[model samples]
Target: MHFAQRIQALEKNVFADMDRAKSQAISKGKKIIDLSLGSSDLPADPEAIATISASLEDPSTYGYLLHHGTLNFRETVGQWYSNRFGVEVDPQREVLTLIGSQEGTAHLPLALLDPGDFALLLDPGYPSHAGGVYLAGGQIYPMPLLAENDFLPVFEDIPSQVLGQAKLMVLSYPHNPTTATASLSFFQEAVNFCRNHGLVLVHDFPYVDIVFEGMTQPPSILQADTQKSLSIEFFTLSKSYNMGGFRIGYAIGNAEIIQALRQVKAVVDFNQYQGILNGAIAALTGEQTTVKKTLARFQSRRDAFIKALNNIGWQVTPPQATMYVWAKLPQTWENKSVEFSTELVAATGVAVSPGAGFGKQGEGYVRFALVHDPHVLELAVEKIAQFLATRT
Candidate 1:
């Protein structure tokens, strides 16, 4: 039996490779300290959990949830967006419930792209962004995010030929892997570029509340495209609200794009369980104290972990947002991110994501997720120090 050609691009996953390595290390009797994935270790807010628990006893929520059934959740999302970003949204037309933001990101391409059309993607971006394009049978033109330019793509560098065939461009910030935050000004420029080029702009905004150092909340793409022209943004409860396991999120933007994605979703699957959306509503409207506490906890871990790395002579710039520390590899391991990560995990039982797994530009770097407690993060660095000493 033969698999479809689309499966070809999905076959070489770096995370899967790392997972096997981690399993081998555990089999060798090493206790693993996993910093490879960004799934938060924090618990969901009690309010959200209680809301879901209550729904389980309500027989009304046990039926299939169609698009119309999600109206209340959509309205809550609209209110949350308005209060947070000061941008008005029509929940009836511009908002769509998603299983998670990843579902929207992965499925939107089917609605936007034709086979062989191009998508302008950030190199070293989240893996699912490229996977979506691949699944849609589209081409990807990676816009390199260089350190010299603050890890934001330079629009002027996108070749005109590539731009001609490109139908969509995806951006995320605070970005994954690199943990780079984009400014409102940068988003304004991106909106202008997309407007001029007739390309749809998609912003994956999973880390909107993960900032540090008293910085303002990251601006939404709608903040720049006030008219919702040629733009859509995806948001998830996973990162900000510690609802990763709940798999609830939403998409908001141009009514047409929202409808298009909704059509694609109709063919894919119905909405997530109504109970989950009810719990998500509780999360969005409930006290934000859990959000604040989660941020403070991650900031503490970031400081402790970065300090430990510097103490071990592996200096790295602390990230401004997201739960990751994107560190350039030491000189000897610069070009061997995958090898370094595999060997380090095998040797020290500390797992981290290899940068190259994200994209070619991600080579020569590694990403450490600050998902563990500060004490565990410090211990992981201590083991890493020993590994580096032996390698050097």
Candidate 2:
């Protein structure tokens, strides 16, 4: 049997492989302490949930929801953006509802790339970013994110040749896996770079509200691209409102790009259940206590986890934002991240994401998601210490 070459690019998946290792550990009677995936374990906002429940009773919401049906939700998103970032948003022209930010990130490439067009992507970016490019038959020019540079890509390093072929550039911060945040100056630099090069700029901003105390809140790309020129930003309720299961998010920015993405979306599928959008609207417009509480809880977990790792002699800096700790593996295991993660999980039932799984530059490190409570995170660190003991 034959399959599309695009599917070939997805044949090797790090998270899927980790899931199998976890299942094997469970089969051997190991109680799994998973720190691999970044899914939030926090509860969704009660107001959001209540709104969804109310929507379910309305028979009008049961049928197919076209673009017009999402007007209310999009208008709410536009207001939210204006209030939070002081940037005016024309919801009707710029905001497009998404099943999740992943969906928009994955599908937008279809709108932007013709076969073999180039997309400038971060080397250790979220996997779906690459997957989307591959599916669109687009070539990828990986921009290395080095620790020496605070895990930010250097625009000057991109070869003139790749820049000539590049159609779009994707950025996300507070970044996943690395948990690195970017400043407004950095975004301004990015906006200027993309505009000069005639490339569309896409920012995956799922962690927009996940900053730790004392840390500067990460800037929106739109904040830098004040006129929404050449840029589009994707936001998900998954990280901010704990609505991963609800599959709700939206894209806001350049009107032309948003419309093109909407065309691609129309061909793929209609909108998700109308009730989810109602819930998202509530989460956006309602009191933000849940958002604050969630950020504080993740910050507590970050402190506890970093302290516990340090207590075990594995010095790791606490992340400023996002719900992950990116740690360089000890010297002996630096080049063997996949092996280390696989064997450690099997032996200790403590699962983590290998840095190499993210990309070539990700080698020599591992990422731990702070999805568990502080106590459980500390316990996981204890198990990690025991596992490291045998390696020494």
Predicted candidate 2 versus true structure: per-residue lDDT over 91-143, tens digit per residue: 99999999999999999999999999999999898999999999999999999
Worst 10 residues of 1 by lDDT: 10-19
Candidate 1 Cα lDDT to native:
0.94
Candidate lDDT scores, in order, read 0.94, 0.94
lDDT of 1 by residue, 229-321 (tens): 999999999998899999999999999999999999999999888899999989889888889999999999999999999999999998999
What is the C-alpha RMSD, rounded to one decimal, of candidate 2?
A: 0.8
| Off by more than 4 A, model 2 | none
Best by lDDT: 1
TM-score of each: 0.99, 0.99
Kindly report which residue pairs in candidate 1 clash with one another.
Answer: none
Worst 10 residues of 2 by lDDT: 211-220
